[model samples]
Target: MLPLSPAPAWAVAGAARVRPGDAAWPSAARWQQLGEQVGGRLIRVQSPLVACRSEPASAACAQLFKAVKNPYFIGDDVALTQTLGWVDAWTSMPSAYAVAARHTSDVVAAVNFAREHRLRLVVKGGGHSYQGTSSAPDSLLVWTRAMNAITLHEAFVAEGCAGQAAPQRAVTVEAGAMWSQVYDAVTTQAGGYVQGGGCMTVGVAGLVQSGGFGSFSKRYGLASGSLLQAEVVTADGQVRIANACTNPELFWGLKGGGGGSLGVVIRLTLRVHELPEDFGAVNFNIKATSPAAFRRLIGRVLDFCSQALIDPHWGEQIRFRRDNTVQVSMVFQGLTRSEAVAVWQPLRDALAREPGDFVVDSSPLSIVSTSARDFWAPTLVKRVLGFIRRDERPGAPRTNVFWPGDQGQAGQVLHGFESAWLPAALLQPNRRDALGDALFAATRHWPVALHFNKGLAGAPAEAIAAARDTAMNPAVLDAFALAILGTQGQPGYPGVAGREPDVALARQQAQALGRAMAELRRLVPDAGAYVSESNYFQPDWQRAFWGANYPRLQAAKRRYDPDGLFFVHHGVGSEDWSADGFSPRT
Candidate 1:
């Protein structure tokens, strides 16, 4: 774990930003002029779910409720976000108006308008933010849903780096492009790989800026580390090119400094890699009969990870459940099916020796591998593999598909979410038993998932080196895995009658999730969390999210957006304003 510096007292309080009822708010003529500047793309935003509240028994209301279940549908809507809300935390709320940005010029116009008018500004692409950072009521929104475009280059170099940097195969992704679209274009069609978020509908710009991790991140490192250049519109409405050679400090801050902070990224260029030979997944479950057996099971699993699975070939998660079961949903790269099975043989044998204490729950261990290129091929996934769920709405693109495992997150209300990086030292022979005990105790409260790919330890030296340069907490470079505990309710938003979230149950589960993470904190008290996945109410957010890198990121934030024209909850320089981002401190 990295040591944290004291929180800075730099931000000063000031007056609130302008809102709907303010006398200085934009008039109808001003809005019309701005709309004309953007080619009439302005939108007066309102949630389509409002119909459900008005006509409870209408057929259209029923269809609308079912459509919210589709992530792509939610992403396409201008007013809705992928997550509905969090109990006593935040709910999805639409901005008063939005500029449906179709190009960089549109984004620039929106930024200028918001800054000049002192309007609360929000940016939304895929709208997958679990913390409700993308949606703000009574604000002006820069909606990038129409800006999605993907282009591949056989050899590309950042501007002003022709002599210093070598050309590499790369892909330029627009702010609104989803991982599903990028995967289809780069890997399925071009036969090359680009690291990105595992979820299909997550936006490229948001994920890259938030230190993205995918199933193959152990081999390729973070998606942000692969960023070569970005076209961004800053607070002053200047479209600047940021890369290793130009605006280098801003480039570093953009990589894992957390999205919607430094500037509005219009597009990004990321290096691509040669496709691996194979991609595969291994899944199974084990149930222990008693507490002692569960502890022993955890120990065996840790030993297996330390011995073999920690390497670059493996990734994904292992879940320790309160039901005395451990669920394995691990993925692998560059390995054939037989090779993957052989790798797990030792654990299988170890479990066989403990028949009296453990049982193979229902399904036996299943290992399957496929040609790497077929992993994201739309046709193959839809017809042959059947591992992904497609957006079945009429006229939806074939590439719009998501993993079945991610279905629970689409439009769901979060209860609580917390993450902590577990350093490799805990996996040592001397401390492994204590780690096992902590895992058991944590499961007594709520399920704990260890996401191996989210951390860089045990990865290739080059992968670790690349990740170290990013603004993500340096602790990730040494942590073997990221332990996460999260709870959520069904697919529903607040204020929707008959479809409202169960607040009582959500609060109850949230407390249990908090207790579960507290158990892990006892082992690594000062562990830094991944910025995009940490607690929404983190007290020392700057230290917890960026660690020693916070000061550097703050410097860049000051240089580019000194007046703080943009605001997201707990984002950089957010301390200068009220929680809603409408009022500055006095």
Candidate 2:
């Protein structure tokens, strides 16, 4: 990639770097040379398309694309696209847009090119978005596959004493770094860690922006709730810190407003939790079907959460196994298995007393694993996806889509869910099962996972304890927040009356769903809906998952990104955003 020459890392990392030797600043010749010479070593996965390139019209674009290899470069492609896992959708964009960025200057150059050309910009790392937001047609995407740096300072780990969880050092990460990287860095490097926060492969920028939820969430808080600071690149081209002291409002917006609607985020600093010196856990299972069993277990699932234990350690999720059995998973955060057992013993006996007696068939099941990874190897999914192909897939049901960063809902998913304890008022229980069915149908093509965090139930609600349940980040995909929208209060289902299914039923349903969620704040008293998967909800989803923070998020958007350049569906879709701000051409 170099022009028969490569520069040293010092030359690249120096405080001031200028394109040398009269080489084209962003040319294939100079970019490749600079990329190769950049000192920070990286293991890249190149885009498959890079191998089949038309010689760059310009030596600059050509050399720049050539220097990085597919495996070394992460691109947008079938092997990289999640869910459908087909090449057609994958091939539309360079699959595997991974680049080994040596320093900030490189990113600056790439970003400038994208802006000059006015191309849709998608920043990808693990390429795990549910809606394929990281990839788009003809998009000038920056795959942060190489900026996987994590600097952990253990001084932030929180030691829980006297019911108060304290803080420790911080972990600063490049946008490309995966949650798994941060987890490992903090857990192994600091000798302690935060148990649950997000999916292992998710990139930090998007997750934190969308108010990430996780296993340790119930005990400590949501991913964004742990955010200490961030280094964000504004649309106008500036890398500024957004945290408590610097642009605090912007800091708050960055933490929970959801991502993509905003500009590129380069780095993030988050607070980590200190695990008990002897941290350990156990899991239990039961055939989760049959109405009575479902009601009993589902009820206690909330009660167990609502009822404060001697120590705060109770969690639950009812998963419908491919085998048709519902896996009632009980996660407890404790120092020792013995200690965990003491807390879970009652939960186990109670769940055993009932079951998943769902409309679907059922069989009791049980398995205990130490970590969520032992139970599910999310990383292995990538390996399994290689067998799939483009021609082998089906087309989309609808061409249009939404990502729920709307009406201020973004911050909840990104920050508020973890910031404070939402009262039971935020959730309405009776309509939940219906929403589950809706979501199950919506994502029937892909795996549909529903968590057990109920904001409606008191005491130990699921939202209070289900941290580190790294299954889904709905905000990354759809523009809707599921339960928080209006459907909760709609007529029919539970306390409501009837649902007209035919004529423009989609819109009606949307409105109804929006209405229900808007009513949730009344139920929890001071609590807001604990937003988890925002794909099904948004700031406009009044009938869905409503909360108290939506207005503040709206106000912030008005003050910043008023032009709507950084706006997304519900996240920053302030009522004031101009309709002409964006075009649907992309």
**Number of backbone collisions per candidate:** 4, 128
Clash count, predicted structure 2: 128
Give each model a TM-score: 0.97, 0.57
Worst 10 residues of 2 by lDDT: 410-419
Model 1 Cα lDDT, one tens digit per residue, 1-586: 2343332343343545898888999999999999999999999998876656777667887787788789999999999998888888888888999999998999999999998898999999999998899999999999998888999998899999999998999999999999999999999888999999888889999999999999989999999999999999999999999999999999999999999998899999999998998999998898898988998899999999899978899999999999999999999998888999899888887787879998874344378777888887655544454677788889999889888888788878899999999999999999998899899999999999999999888889988988899999899999999999999887776667788889899889999998988899899888888878878887778878889998788778888988888889988788777899887764
Q: Where in model 2 is the C-alpha error above 4 Å?
A: 1-79, 84-100, 154-168, 194-196, 278-282, 288-305, 308-311, 320-326, 344-532, 536-586
For model 2, how does the per-residue alpha-carbon lDDT over 210-295 read when each residue is reduced to its tens digit?
67655444455456666766776665556667766566677777665656655667788776555544423333444545434443
Instruction: Provide the global lDDT of candidate 1 against the true structure.
Output: 0.88
- What local distance difference test score does each model get? 0.88, 0.42
